[model samples]
Target chain A: MEHPGEGTRNGGSFVVSCESVSFSYPGSGRPALSDVSFELRPGEYVGVVGPNGGGKSTLVRLLNGLLKPDSGRVLVSGRDPATEPFEVRKHLGILFQDPENGLVAPFVEDDVAFGLENLGVPRKEMRDRVAGAIRAVGLEGFERREPDTLSGGEKQRVALAGLLAVEPDILVLDEPTSMLDAAGRREVLAYLETLRAEKTVLHVTHHLEELVRSDRILVLNGGELVADKTPERFLSDADLLRENRLVLPVVQRLALEIGLSPARLRTPETLAEAILAKTESGTRAG
Target chain B: MRLELRDVRYVYAPGTPFEVEALRGVSLVVEPGEVLGIVGGTGSGKSTLVQHMNLLLTPTGGEVLVDGVDATTLKKSELRRRVGLVFQFPESALFAPTVEEDVAFAPRQLGLDEEEVQERVLESLRALEAGELAARSPFALSGGEKRRAAIAGVLAMKPEVLVLDEPTAGLDPATREDLLALILGLRNAGISVVLVSHDLDEVAEVADRVCALQEGRVRAIGTPAEVFYREPAQAPATVRVASLLRESKPEIGAPVRFAETLDALRALQGA
Candidate 1:
């Protein structure tokens, strides 16, 4: 959690900065978010996870200027989102929790082109952008297909393509894979991995496994920032995760139960290696 | 009670340009006091097959028998009352101002006396541990509370069997565990449960029997241990870990549950 005024490190500039942000829905008794602060470095993949209604969505909305904070400042790329929303939006693209809600056009290509058309980009350029986005999401052949008829995974890919067409530098996704099945989840995650090199992603999800590779994780509880650390440190604290109503990934939980350090065994492959090492050691000891 | 589907087949917009075969010759049974977990990928006809269980959609072909009586032959309302269907995102089903009113709506529609309807409402809320939300507006309640209230609406009808589609979707870990426990409680009380979910871990935990669906058809059906450990695609993460271990030590069985996997790992450590 670097401070907002801190000089840039490793030649990566701060893409998003939130300072003492707080917000409450109208007529609601309690605030939805309170005194939340964090910084997103360029090309950094950060995961936001918390219980439902824990302000994860609200925080992202503030970052995108969709919702103005009640008491604090939010800056996207050194510009105040509340005051310079259009300028901030130019560098940011967001994918919401429900893919159906984000899609508007009946056909896939139309939906992907809708944003570009709004920007009044020339027809030729729009065509190239749409095609490139569709290819990026692995939906090149689905250009004319009806979005409603496509499976959940394909529909999400179309939505992602629509976002990618704008060519934003930062990507904010709120539970993008929550509604999909196992195969669909795998597909979306796999596609996202390919973007890690070129994009700064702020991914909010309930699945802990999805965050295993994240550079940093922010844990929210009851509308407050509870923990900000590397994903390994955040997930290794079993009690902290349970108290915040987050479930550990199944393989990670098994590793912890067997007295293995989950921080070291982040993935199934590493868990297998640790087990094999233990077996070889036991054979030699005998 | 036993609910059986014999070679059930369903088609969407049949004979039209948009015609698509949703289910093809799917057969399964839900015995009384048991949880039948259905697992499938998207577009697998899991939702379509469950709709057939309660006659929400009469099969285009084959038979759906509710305790030996053809569901298609029964009145739609009667069949629905016997087999309560909870759709995915059950919170959308809540429309009444208050949770109590929503829960009582189904019983009142059955022409039950007002006193009986009131009793059913309270009982249903209690069954789901949602009695505290009785007077609250459904829209004002949190996501988890609203989901429980919606489920209570169907439970108030006192159905013999319950069908839930992706009941745990979009729910947090704690809320998911609570709902799973309630489903098991319903089974213990002799209410058959047909749970359709994509979460293999949850199915492995609560299901006595499991069925896998692929491309609108039944791919496999057996006990949870059999179905999950056998299917690599639908296996839980714990089972996958066991599969990796088994690659090195064949005698170390492919354990499906956390406890079994822990025991296997302990055995490896000692060996």
Candidate 2:
């Protein structure tokens, strides 16, 4: 709901900024990330996409102070994460690819409260926050359910609720919906659409369609920041998508393969309309 | 080899307060050398159903038959050898240091001589286009390579049937496409494939028949066009597009695959 570039970057404030960051795993031949630099203005929903080994996860780990960059710096709200991990953590909440792995507590309510407990929040306030967070993710009735027993969608929401309880400034979600089925994906994406209005979100995913609404899209390939463009501009380039090993959404791919401009027809309805218009014109011309 | 499940029922933690019926009398047949796609939402008993095919999880009630023989009477190891299961993120199960040893572990366990084990390992890696990765460490490979290596481990057993649960779950598009082609190639080589996936489009492209599960029961089972179009909202994008086109142009035929959808539109243009 919040228009990008409305009240963030121009005012000299960036929620997340990386400066010439480079990192490599120990004993690995190639650097996982090389000289990657980007900045996220407040309330900007950015999607990072690339091939599997292209360092999307590495960048996420670097942003959260989980891995130190071999060179360059990562800043959260202008504070260095390496020197101030706890302070940085308060501003960054990460929902890993596997929600089951991220979940620590047995019960949903207690899982949401785990973060607040670590923050040393008062007991009385923790209860309200936990309830609010659970409600935020639409898990109201699942408060007492064991996380292991819930459906995949519900478990993902529970993991999200845990993050929401902390009220972090930015949310870094790494393939949050990849493990989910169609219904589960819809559930998580719907919640994120609402959350994006208030939170600076950096979503990393292999599925490009999920980034259609993203304010900006960043492409990483072979450990480099390959492209940074608006979603419309980024997705329209069939060559770019192919070069990066990213596939277009079904409708978009259809549009491309059918000799139509990929940018013009995105959704199923529009594609159908375009086909109809083209056929009608062809019939008339013939 | 034909794999058949007759009224298979699987209950988790049976007879306990926390018991949950994961599969309730689900029945299906996997024909020889055909791709049988199993699709459902999360926790829809898709995984449970496939596990039953390989005897990973024995059905609590009813029968799982292989080629008209009851599965319980068949030796468990022999059943596993006849049917290989590749779980979701199967790469995580790779433990041997080198990709070669990891792939050879199963064949070696079957008491195949080292010479034959080495031959099977090479053949399996070649089948997955991962023969070059044999000397590489499993931990050092890329995600797609790791997946291929993991699958090669299953293929080394030379099972007649392969059941892959969400093979393309987290893969990039190119890798996903390659894996789908590999599934089809397996079928061409006289190996039946039971593909359990949440990706309907890919399933539509590869599956000879599709089985949709809803709440541990068969919601629909037929060709992709029959099952997918029956549930329009849940159908593959091509099928959905064709259906939408039909609203205005009633002549537009429903297409289950991408190429067929394009052909249908081209026919309209030609008309």
Candidate 3:
């Protein structure tokens, strides 16, 4: 599961690094990102969260060299993305907010093989890789189905399979499940959990609940890196979250409001258990 | 101000190889001054159902009635003005150079005088809290601001019934809260609203009643507590949590909102 380019950067620990990076869109009065710096270690799950227009998309684009920083530097595996764009892209697989934008080929299997074909993989190896990737995303029987015929969630899975076919080291997903329903969201998230052991995932989302399980969270606000901490520390600060235009998850907020510790009620199951425990203890005392 | 669909059915590309039935005998009613939330999975015909409200799409084998009058017999322009339909990602439809011009387009096209059109435009902008963005180009506004401006364009038409298709699809949390509040305000001001959304929590918060659509059919329709609590898989997180607790503690009620769920749990503990 080790990355081929692992030991080439920061003593083989950090896979991606941003040093005082700043960027502004053309004609924009304010910078989209300013003096933002962070580093991702190998196989670490980092969640990037902020409000709309909070420079999240900008940061993801910077990571893959799709958009170069206006100032400072961005490095992937000890190589600058601006200078070594091809090398950076070879190791990075980015899924954008809209799956339609990433899906180019008409058929599902062909789309998964597009990147492998670009890398000039042998025909036999490409077929095997495509089959494995599709199976990984649970889209095995949909090889010949047209991309347009798939549902929103299926289309996103197809896009993920396309990313996995290349076997990239770093996976950057920007709001990958934003357009999906509850079932679809769970489907995509379940697959992402399986990927945690092998790949470094940088998930950018507006849903604070989605970040509750991440190893670390990077909070952005008004083009600034406002907070960098574990998910527990980040979720505990209600005022900070509100100030950054984010709302606490419903369960967390309910726990905080009802004099219960939010940390103990991170999920709906736990929240239900806590309530039942309280009811039983209260009845026994009565 | 009431709108109803009578066994409405719509088929896309009828009699062709790619034909598909989007809506199948789906019927619902929106009472005056009430918020009717429509919940469904993807391709459940929520958008197709709303399009029939404004006469944008004619039902292949059914009738749309507004205040007991057959909508098909009504003038298309008049029906459009009376029933404003806001499509998904309406901001992407903004084409005018400036926000004011975009908002003013509908009122002017309705043959309102220049002064009246200006008044309507300003009023709609103020209604959505976007008056400050009047002169800015629609292209220049942020995602939230652009959404408000697009809604203002529809509000300028002064529709009696407003149908929104996934209005809060890509909005951030704070922006989403603001937009929900705006929808409530519109309902309080006597405008009936039909909200089609996938966010169950949002629907639970603002909807007076909710209808569930599955595979182009009406699956369930009732108050938020009744409809949301009926199916654990489709319920909001708060209701699902309540349902889970109810298995062990039967006294706890089905609470759809966070505040209500907390209060219900506290009451159970107190008793």
Candidate 4:
């Protein structure tokens, strides 16, 4: 029913669209999500963060069609996920924060191959895809080992290998580094950065420091979209950010709080250029 | 002393194929009024090392002495009365449906009377400022609220020492700063606190004594300033500025640990 070669793009368009969506788990009076709307084009990396459980995960699940919105519509590749759930799942790959829950194969190679095999792919083709995925995650000669034997980063790599083997156009990660130690988080995050090409990524996390590298950030508070802007613009709003529970990388926070404009947020050289660019954009808009 | 670990070592799956030694020969003591911070990259054995102080992890090769009692010999029943360990997202550890019940878990586990447990729960809720949410479903509270509820569960036990593992991991900047402020208040009341985290700057800011671990060994240990006080050879941008001018009175610029502004660094140059 599925293969790496199949695609949904008719003439190239957005991979996801969330319109006025709100969700609430069973028996919970408060809505987990509130009036949210956004469009994710292909190959765009967007980081979603908010106070813990402010509907980051719920919203991402809506993007790929994992959780249907209670009232609003969530479309995947121009199709309502609720109407075509199976088809929607085929085009997107998900990687949760915990590696233990998503991966099932005993051996590294077997685990990666598990996803491909589900599609009933030919054995030779599945083998090739598995190798390519493992190589992408930078794990060589780790095909036969059990997951427990691998280190935290390595196991995540294997889980990623499994996700990548499916050849999805978009990847959604749910705090893949939350359980890892410092070095392991760096390794996984660095690896994800390299995978940014040709794959739309929606990283759900509250770690403000981790969002600096993202192209854009969406901040949620009590199921409300409080801020939607570039990481620099988001961080520059020093007073506004204080109301939420998220923290920024220290130096960045200080730079922003000290009157550095969004454009002047990077290093001094970039800061100067950013200041210039901001003036230009502001003037152009004016 | 509130807590002490003279020499503690922990090995995971001893004598097996997965015989990975976690903590190799560690020693430290938290005085009655000290806030000790532990910092390390993942697998540096910080978690394994902290668990020993509260007897969460029985020392496999050494001794853990808490409040003059060697944890190596005390039963868990006896140890629960003295030391309390609050883990990351302790809300996940909440089994009771309601907030009030969850806070009363530890006290009830100690076989306290119902009235005493109720009183402890009330006091704990008041201390964490979640007194208003006691009857509500803990699962339904805000993220910060849930975390506070989890801490209240431990506080109800009324232990002398509190050990938290990455207490502010998923929280936003504002919530994290607020939560840490409350914990600092608890420390002021003489609760020896041991905080284990990966953020060096955070530990540098609040910890009286900071310990950095690497590859199953303690790399550096001393007062927070002594351990991370140097211009942080591998420090972030702010720390580099502070370290660059350590010779001058050094009024400011210490990365996440403190103020990171050009005012002090520039002031130093002018002076």
Off by over 4 Å in 3: A1-14, A84-86, A100-117, A122-155, B13-19
In order of appearance, the predictions have TM-scores of 0.91, 0.94, 0.90, 0.84
* Runs in model 2 lying further than 4 Å from the true structure: A1-14, A138-140, A150-154, A280-286
* iRMS values for every prediction: 2.2, 2.0, 2.4, 6.4
Candidate 1 lDDT score at position B204: 76
Clashing pairs in 2: none
Where's the lowest-lDDT run of ten residues in candidate 3 chain B? B13-22
Error of 1 at A35 (Å): 1.4
lDDT of 2 by residue, A5-28 (tens): 233434556488887899998878
Worst 10 residues of 1 chain A by lDDT: A2-11
Rate residue B24 of model 2 by lDDT.
Answer: 89
Q: At residue B43, give the lDDT of candidate 2.
A: 76
Roughly what TM-score does model 4 have, to 2 decimal places?
A: 0.84
Question: What are the DockQ scores of the candidates, in order?
Answer: 0.55, 0.63, 0.51, 0.35
Give the best candidate by TM-score. 2
Task: Please provide, for model 1 over A108-218, each residue's C-alpha lDDT reduced to its tens digit, 9 standing for 90 to 100.
Answer: 999999878868788999999999999987787778777766655567788888999998889999878766777778877888898895888999888888888988898
RMSD values for the candidates in order, in angstroms, are 2.8, 2.9, 3.5, 6.2
Full-model lDDT, candidate 2: 0.86
Query: Tens digits of per-residue lDDT for model 2 on B55-156?
Result: 899899989999999999999999999999998778889999899999999999999999999999999999888889999899888778899999999999
Identify the runs in model 1 with alpha carbons over 4 angstroms from their true place: A1-14, A79-88
